[model samples]
Target chain A: MSHPVACCYLKTGRALMSTQRPDARQLPSRRIADDLRQAIETGELLPGARLPSERELAGQYGTARNTAREAIRLLTDEGLVIPEHGRGVFVRRESPLIRLGNDRYSHKYRESGLSPFLLECAKQGKTGRFEVLSIDQAQPSAEVARHLRLPMSEPSVLVRENVFYADQDPVHRVTTYIPWTIAEGTGLLNPEVGHPYGIHGILEERGHTMTRLRESVSARMPKPEETRYLHLPPAVPVLDVLHLSIDQDHNPYELTRFVMRADLTGLLYDTPIE
Target chain B: MSHPVACCYLKTGRALMSTQRPDARQLPSRRIADDLRQAIETGELLPGARLPSERELAGQYGTARNTAREAIRLLTDEGLVIPEHGRGVFVRRESPLIRLGNDRYSHKYRESGLSPFLLECAKQGKTGRFEVLSIDQAQPSAEVARHLRLPMSEPSVLVRENVFYADQDPVHRVTTYIPWTIAEGTGLLNPEVGHPYGIHGILEERGHTMTRLRESVSARMPKPEETRYLHLPPAVPVLDVLHLSIDQDHNPYELTRFVMRADLTGLLYDTPIE
Candidate 1:
């Protein structure tokens, strides 16, 4: 029942909450999560701070132990705290990932010699790297074939898959698909290992200039295999984005199924209105 | 344990699955959720389809009763099913909520007399409506203040709050913040009951002439209040977005916080890459 690490955090957080408006009529689970989330947001409980155990929280809040556990589960789902199997929960470490926005396509970034992902990391004062999980020539899903405008008789596509790491965390898993004709003709069917700017550079070099993109985003609980592959924790959802990379001629030469840990990533879109 | 409604759905879903590739290696809970979700997607279980009760699912899947309940919870989180207390779960009725994209500021939509939200619903073959909750002059939170570029001494902001419904389901709860200067000068502070295009119309007429929009999108578990207001089910996450609306002179005129039910909404972003 003892909480050795959370004792100091509790004192500071309570003092901080007193100055704010009352929580008003939230349930025990919500109040607890809100209190801790506030503590995390306000810097009363720093990242990596160990949270009070369920038993200690139950005793402190005078609520049933299960309610306290639910509070932690809520925070876990919010990506505010992470539980380490036998070790207790700790405030989740948050490292911002640069949202690869429309600017990544700019000639400046492409000419800078750093991949857009790496440029983003540098801007954010971090380092980025990607490890290739695979590169293969294979028949694609029907959705992919359709997006690439490949004929039903088309046989294969060059699929390049990798896990992008930001701040040493595996943040994104991407699978890029290109039709066989372009893949074979552009010499992208077999990539030279670890090219800068990833596939965008390859496409640019081959005269397939990417000018527009259409992206659809959805959230879903990851399947078990995805959980393992993405290192996602329980209650963490995946942000699945389907991107159709269009060229100057309006051809969708690249179709990417991008998956990111919802708990950790934020996407930004900025564009001129009219 | 008897399921009067789901029996025919199961047979047809199984037949459909046979023609499609089988789901390999998914656990019992996942396979159960996947089957029902497939049924929902393929029209075997149409919108408002009554899902089998937990007991019925348990009997059908040969899983522990709790496992079947977990399966239902998964679908609920995906926003594919809605669980009504004492009434069992139903396939969630989805009406598209048009993602407020960069094009909303385009003269075409602005001049079309339909607000972007209305235009989106119309495009998807449905009607959209919004009910005003409250309008007041108040100090916004720090985040909103920053986005509005309000000076510290600025007294108040005109806050317009409303809930948007698509096909009678509450889909978005938004709070729009406008700086005091604009609020006072334009007579928008205590204006009419509704503006057709919402805040954008007011801004356009007042010469704000929005030229750019920056949006950040993330997902989180809805608060208890949000659950009540939006009628969100347990485990369903809400897609939370923050918008910074900018004028030609690079001044931020509107700061809007938008919350939408994740299960029923798909956000599409189409933009020029470079």
Candidate 2:
């Protein structure tokens, strides 16, 4: 039996075994895949090259043909190669696509003529509700002022906090900001109206229209308060999406910071039609 | 002070408390938002209904006006409410988009392209290589055989396993498979071909043209081997994407399973284009 690829495969196989000794009998395909996979990595077989026939492989490895097939199936799944029916398989070296802002609502839902939250809700076959935690008019904190683009001396700022739930599950926590100047008219400064239309409605009623949005995302370990509100098990990481919506005039009308469970919600992005 | 919406908000807030104490700092705006959010949930607000004015809501809750405004903003960020500049915030609801397979891949790669591994590498401007863990041909277990639609009595299967790394950091662990019959004539079956083209390349050459793919995703606590290979922290979870690709004849030629670190990869889905 010719052992051309076998030698290279064996060398790479040993390097892989150095980490942990797996249960050989339970997962033979894994062991076989690892052997040939290592050979490819070590450059024993050049890229865009062809592999030996299955009969040849079985003889060299002393394994059944099905096991060899499993090894090949694993590589094909990773976008590492292209398989042609009735022909043969070849190496694929195409670079994985690199996308930016694809997880953003601004990119995915902007065109649906619906808000990002609504889109997310209906997709899950669930509904969303906002349970405002606190609403207060106070001197803008330095951080709040920076985010809302309010002056340090801004005498009044509106802070609205809420926990968002889907199917009775707490899915999001957010705090939004609005500077006093933009919020002062039309009796919006009064808290007496209970919870009225969201800021978009109020701003629109006041003649300001939102035209653009910006967001920054980061991941961090969840805090206790977050765990309690989100019903998260300890140590579940959170995806923080902090976004600001600017009106047509390029003025910041709303600054929102959101904390969400990383696993439950999947983000989607759509490229702007060219 | 009237409390038209207070009762509704309090009832739900109490349910969410998990514990019994009611915190006093919570204001009417919160109650209103909560109440309105609940209304939305119970279908009381309907998807397109207009909410009361800030003054109207403030009067309804007997709170100051700013409180009412803040509550609305909270709903906006959660994607429950759509705030049009001039059009008061209305119930923003829409169905989920039907995503195409190609779109899904494009989005996932774009959002986290070359994330941590690439980030570190690019910052230093260095290139890395794939390390083979093991490669061999093995018999397919019942499960592998079922997925491949192959009979158990057929020749042995081909299985390949590998771990991808960047500077020794385990990025992903994969198990690949290919059937013996198709691979028998192809050089891929031979051990001497060793580093032959990636499996995809091998199949393409063998006349198996792959045009469609199916991916099933699940999340779980990482296993010991997964933890060690990916070097994942205890708190982080693992996401497994099982890929099955069939040739033009509708026969699955490859089945590859990939385990990725949740912290390192953020999966993105794209809304199908109409």
Candidate 3:
């Protein structure tokens, strides 16, 4: 029951406007930023194209050097451009979009020896790996407890955390939770399950074959810790994907939350329309 | 093939860190912003709670008032808080998350008189409406043309643009394109389709019964025009959903792009994992 805060005034027909006219009263920096942003969007400035130096921009726009610097900072905050320490600023090149679809969970692929991340990376000619952060028993959070149908008073979940990487760059931080009943005396408690099918494969062997998956997707600015872990740039948001795997008996057996760098991830879903 | 730009350095095991310690060498403004950001994230400062006055924060943190102001500015840019014209700053209250699921397109709901947006609003107890921005014939973009399998040289699509609002707050900007072959002499060309079944119903009547749908989802920062149209706050990213409708004959019939405010919208997909 999250309530949206009132953040904007009601405006009509604004979208139909053809161009964003430069308002005479706008700050000089904003006008400059808008010009550069349009150029980037319209392909005038391609990805990885270096922007004119602040001095040149200032001279061209007839603004102060600080005004030009502020405009660059504005683009940097929007994630449109990156400023190198010694080099000039350039448009940020996007990562290859890895489209995750419903078929990704199919048994055919699950049995393919590669984990889903690695499989997707292989499809796109990129190398993928993950580092296990920890595997330990922990009290389930209220939301996790509700989803897993665990008793309120029980500390009954094994938490496995990992950081997934694409070509050595951190892309997603995944935290998985399993009920102690399902995790105990199983490979689920270990960081490396040493199975081609991974954790889900082990679950299947224990009769918890996944028949369905429900994904809840949202996005938000990364917290400081996530920023550090993901090495996210300023102003880049992260996709928060909450996945629940349901077994044949309709039991929600597993819950995993993936915090992914939005710039590098795309989700595709092809489903029969009911 | 969108390549992810190398944005972050390789980092491992950072997620296991217990706390984000304040670095002694960090700038005063950054350190102050970090403290305030931590307060906001940890619920020490609840949504809508007023932050301390700049003078108070400066005195408390042994920093200049300008430094305190800069810290607050950082929070504002991150969309963690908002400042009033005359009043002090307060933590931003989030909008209620609208969970859009696969069932939203079910024929049962489509037959219910209300449009999909209105139906969802009824369920959520929030008023929803949309303003038809424009309805006109246009040349399809290359992507749209390819999806509809249209000849490259034809102005062969009718485009309908609308802005959806929940509780009077704009939340999504949608642009739908229908190949002229399907749109000719149909209600689909009208801004208001004037039918309970909406556009899909019209497509069905015209022998294009939708059997499947494909949605490609990505996210990024809003362009300046989007910021104005959606009334987005600084640092709020948007979800870009590209939708294609496939008919029973496996013909792609419709293509629509929905640019949604990430802060207020969530997408839910419940599907059997094949």
Candidate 4:
């Protein structure tokens, strides 16, 4: 059984402040997280056991609903708890053990232009599935306008927002946009039904390929909707990665914006020597 | 005049509630940062502008001392501001733009049994200098203990600490611990002087080398000291990457904890065919 990780005093020689183990009364939410964490560790709360509703748990722990919820979120992020939509949260049977390495990505891009990461997902039975949220052939926002190099007057375009799940759990959520005229001629015009090929794979097969790709990564606190969809805790960080793929002619083909559960994926890189 | 970054809107669409647009009532510190950003875009600030001192800038902007300092820190993480200890912050006149995608780490490892990432640093240029922080030849921590297969009582000896900058700005901060005792034997034992070889390079020379590596990536809010060392803004995120390297016998050689500036580095990966 695991307990709250007890790290030895690292700054042992520092004399500025006397160090003492934080007693139970120090922090309300942290104390709740620890109390519940102890229960989970000691088998008082078995794996897959349905935890009490947030309000009940709050009352039991003698804390506010928000504090109890926050504690649950911490355990959730640590892979100890699982929250089910429209259902009570449960203890996760096991933590997701990820193997972080670069072997899969290099093989895909070298042998086939298809992203190896995507290929590995398929092979590992972690095939990507999308639940289309909303689709619109609307005017591109200023940001999209610049990325796609469309004139401000380029009118309405196609925008699709969806959540991508692996093994029935939401892992990423994306909102992608493209010029309507360009997309209208393509199969992506149908938002209700997703094509067998992801948009990138489809684009490559159609010879409207992305010869160059640029990406930017950042992180921020998740908002309410994102937190709900991701089932993430307030302290759990998300990876905000923006991908811009351009054609051989340097014409931007697509601009994809997405957030991924950082714990689920490791960024890998192998650059060509100059 | 530069506009407030659009990122805040993507985060919270209710921009009206959060953002205060550039107005006459704007604080001088904010105004200073905005003005400098605009001047950079317009080539007025140029590169390497010896920025006004914190006190001077506070006087110029009619703002408090702390606010002016924070404004500069924000720009520093944006890759526009460069600060020097004892010297005033400057507009980064010329700093090597380190490209993350140009070198293939795997191939270098396969050929030389050592990575260029370590070698290149040891063989420094005018701008490159590696400062070794604290080095402890002591027992591994709990995380390292599990990886090195050391019993709770049996000490799996190691060293852990940071790598500082040549220009006194932190390039990357890392704490690496290895199980092998050769690390202590290899004349690489002092924090006051730089090491002749880096971790990987030294391991290769010692004849126990890693053929592959695995990295786990995540991001988090930087601790106060980390933010100051990395010269990061409180809002800016830092990449927390952990690398585990195994030797030919599949024995773990090193466990490295690294924190990189999310904005400064791009991580790329190419996987091999299965």
Give the number of the best model, judged by TM-score: 3
Clashing pairs in 1: B79-B263
Q: TM-score for the second chain in candidate 2?
A: 0.52
Q: Whose DockQ is greatest here?
A: 3
| Ranking 2 against 3 by TM-score, winner | 3
**Considering just chain B, what TM-score does every model have?**
0.73, 0.52, 0.85, 0.56
Give the TM-score (vs. native) of candidate 1: 0.77
iRMSD of all candidate structures: 2.2, 9.6, 1.1, 6.5
True-contact fraction for model 1?
0.65
Better of 2 and 4 by DockQ: 4
Q: Which scores better on lDDT, 2 or 3? A: 3
Task: Please identify which of the two predictions, 1 or 4, would achieve the higher DockQ against the true structure.
Answer: 1
Number of backbone-clashing residue pairs for each candidate, in the order shown: 1, 119, 17, 12
lDDT of each: 0.74, 0.58, 0.80, 0.60
Q: What 10-residue stretch in candidate 2 chain B is worst by lDDT?
A: B96-105
Q: Please give, as one word, the docking class of candidate 4.
A: incorrect
Stretches of candidate 1 exceeding 4 Å from the true structure: A1-52, A56-81, A91-97, A153-156, A193-198, B1-84, B89-97, B153-155, B190-198
Per-residue lDDT of B31-107 in model 2, one digit per residue for the tens?
Answer: 67777778887898888888777777877775567678778765653446766555676876542211112232222
- Cα lDDT for residue B235, candidate 3: 73
Q: Best candidate per lDDT, number?
A: 3
* Residue range with the least summed lDDT across 10 consecutive positions in model 2 chain A: A94-103
Better of 1 and 2 by DockQ: 1
Model 3 TM-score, all chains together: 0.87
